[model samples]
Target: MDIQEKARPPAEVYDAQFVPALFAQWGQVVCAEASVREGDRILDVACGTGALTLAAADIAGPSGSVVGLDVNPEMLAVARRKPAQIEWLEGAAEALPFPDNSFDAVVSQFGFMFFEDKPKALAEMMRVLKPKGGLAVAVCDAVENSPGYGAFALLLDRLFGKEAGNAFRAPFSLGEAGQLTAICREAGLSHAEVVRRNGKVRFKSIDALVSTERACAWTLGGVLNDEQFERLLNESLSVLEPFTVDSGAVEFGMASLIIKARKV
Candidate 1:
């Protein structure tokens, strides 16, 4: 598999089973911060498979409207197969296709990492929010904060060695709380709160983990050519062989960051 094409595994893997569960996991926290009320319009940026969009629909009720936006057609296809209660639009976070101050709230789950330009995306998120509207973007902290990922990453490094394995950069400025605060401030967000949600999702086995790696292609960023990709894949699989038990079912937990703010 071309690793760069599928770098964000969480988006693709969770497009099925995990997306809804992740929504259910953070539903209340997001709703509480979003301050959703009847008749309020909401926007879910990079809505992925529409988990947060559906969650926003639940909170917005029939009176409020929820618009889900995503740039990935494959992911959007999975989202479209769901019920048609939500308005799913094709768009990018860096350039939202909505009027200024159009939404009472804007929410994104685990999407900031994929953004090529975070400040530009944040500014767009701010622009879409109505005056005083809330914005909540959830992202996972560094691998160190997430135990399952740390172990998974360690295994990758051991198998691929430091040179080839360090392709994973946690993808965002998540480890720097101060940096996040400053970004929010620059984006014209006020009353911001950086909350840590220490949570974990258990995989049935190591094969499941491998499946996730294959589908998402986390580490091989363009640096790994076809030969290196095959070698790394074989080496990683060999390393994971011992961890496979009871048909390769294993449990792994993740710690995530839930940053909430209000557009000034």
Candidate 2:
């Protein structure tokens, strides 16, 4: 079956399933890189379900201010329910709602790759940062560098087609260090550097990994029919077994890049 455009995944499922397993840990990493301090004003663009935004708020503390913005109202709804007292706004990265020079630090984790206009979004991020403000943006490393996913992507191609394969591969669009650094420079950000870091991806089981992808529009959500989904799930058992530990959880090493810069 061919991949079809679909509504973004259900935010509740995203928040409940993938957030803890995949995105939560990176929150602190991005916040630390952005140098979020006790009283800094921070912004999290494309703050899906507020995983990274929550981390930023903790670092920023009660005295500090943090805002989480996303285009999806569903995601923002989930984010707004989080316990932290931070601002949750419905917005897009390409056009930030606040005034220019609005934040002491800006951090986005694993979110930039999906922007409709990457250049415009990056410029918008730069526009909102105060001079010398920290900028830390994270994206998945290239498919080639992420072996488990790389193999899974190819399997998708075999089972579905290039379109399905690409759907799975889409998240790593900003993987190259040089390319990311160049993009930052082109956006007029200063001292931009892209550092690749290793991370672990853990799913409670092989089924969990397959199911999570099925729930996410960025990956396989609308792409797989029930039969296709079952086929992929069944096929993935043996394919993903190498990464599965004795406890039946799937674990693999993934890489991510953090593009750090200053707005000076």
Candidate 3:
């Protein structure tokens, strides 16, 4: 939990741990839904460590062009080291640097929840897409929908405080399909369609799960002191035991709301 000053950056932990456990599979899903094609221009907004962006590049191929953009330079730095002939840009979602109608498709995975101006960010995505370009976004479903996480959230509340607990639920903030659909419509992304899909999360052990969240800014955001994090970890052993498999790895069901739309 105490990512020491000399420790590997949190972004590295995310690419090494979080991506394989959660975001990696969804990368293909988002790209496919966004209709990424060879020789097409593609943009991945909030493309942390190039999960979805890498997927897009493969599909787009040597003939196609792909760009990954994110506000966090630390994350982008991690992305740049990956071996891919694609552009990696550092920028905000609310104000994309590309010109209008620039990309054939735009996609994001599990990043929309962090956008401060959701509507404006969605609009910016739409604005950059070529006419009739595809758009897709995937956000984790609510904490209530994920049993293990729900228990963890309650544990956080019981131990740390409501604020600490709420931080854990931030990724699930946009879980409601209706709310996301409304945001798309309001952003001038016409005919947005949302579908609920089941997903799964896995970690080597309960301790790995707890420690990963402790390091992830998207989740715990370093709110807990080292002692408090250790406390949470100890308590989670019992709270999350139901989801732990015989191999001692923690596995549980999750859901994501995949929003698909097109620019007209």
Candidate 4:
């Protein structure tokens, strides 16, 4: 299957109310360091649920502009309802709708892994950015680094073997710092740097977290089947039994890498 189809969830669960808030919290932190000047135009590619878009909007203020684009209509819908000031557009990262050198800054949060054509998306991001403009993209580190999700991943592998597991090259391709920097260079970006980030993966409950798996379609794509999926769902809940804390809340140590580059 193509990337888009593979990325589509079983249903449009992103329309849920809490989804936007969930993403916005971390999105703000991810784009926190990006410097924006007055009247600067920014583009948020793969703007899932408008997390980066909303953050960019906050940075751009009124005089400046922030354009959020994503291929998923469901995600765009969730993004549009937030404040209504951010310009929400439906587009693919591989083929941006803006002209060359159109944006002062381009940012993405946890999106580079899902791109079918990494080079194409990076090229598009570069083309839309003005000379010497900034680009920042963040991606989850490898499964080994993200130990917080160890139980969750173990359950998945138990249910589905290595073949259909989450080991698919797509998600793990840029998991390494060196690999991510190399990808930036290959995409025609310069002055690349990778920042290691430690974060938390919080969940209300194991079941709730597993249920939201559908919303994280891009990651679970092609990783599970009907029988295997159900088995994993049930097994994961059992695995999370010991980790239960107060109020059905659980937090795990998460690791990620922030790749910053310059369009020159």
| Candidate 4 error regions (>4 Å) | 1-12, 15-22, 167-173, 214-216, 219-230
* Per-candidate local distance difference test: 0.69, 0.86, 0.88, 0.70
lDDT of 1 at 78: 80
| Model 2 root mean square deviation, Cα atoms | 3.2
lDDT by residue for model 2 (198-251), tens: 887888888877777887877777788888888998899988889898789888
Lowest lDDT 10-residue stretch of candidate 3: 1-10
Q: Sort by lDDT, best first.
A: 3, 2, 4, 1
The TM-score of predicted model 4 comes to: 0.83
Q: Write the per-residue lDDT of candidate 1 for residues 94-145, one digit (tens) a residue.
A: 9999889899998887778777777788889888899889888877677766
Ranking by TM-score: 3, 2, 4, 1
Q: Give residue 144's error in model 1 in angstroms.
A: 0.7
The segments of candidate 1 whose C-alpha lies over 4 angstroms from its true place after superposition are: 1-13, 17-24, 168-173, 217-248
Alpha-carbon lDDT of model 1? 0.69
Q: Give the distance in Å from residue 196's predicted Cα in candidate 2 to where it truly belongs.
A: 0.9
Clashing residue pairs in candidate 3, if any? none
Reference-based TM-score of each model:
0.80, 0.94, 0.95, 0.83
Better of 2 and 4 by lDDT: 2
Clashing pairs in 4: none
- Candidate 3 lDDT over residue span 156-255, tens digit each: 9999889999988888898898898789878876688998888898988998888788777767856887888888888989999999997899999888
Clashes of each: 8, 0, 0, 0
The number of residue pairs in model 3 that clash at the backbone is: 0
In terms of lDDT, model 2 sits at: 0.86
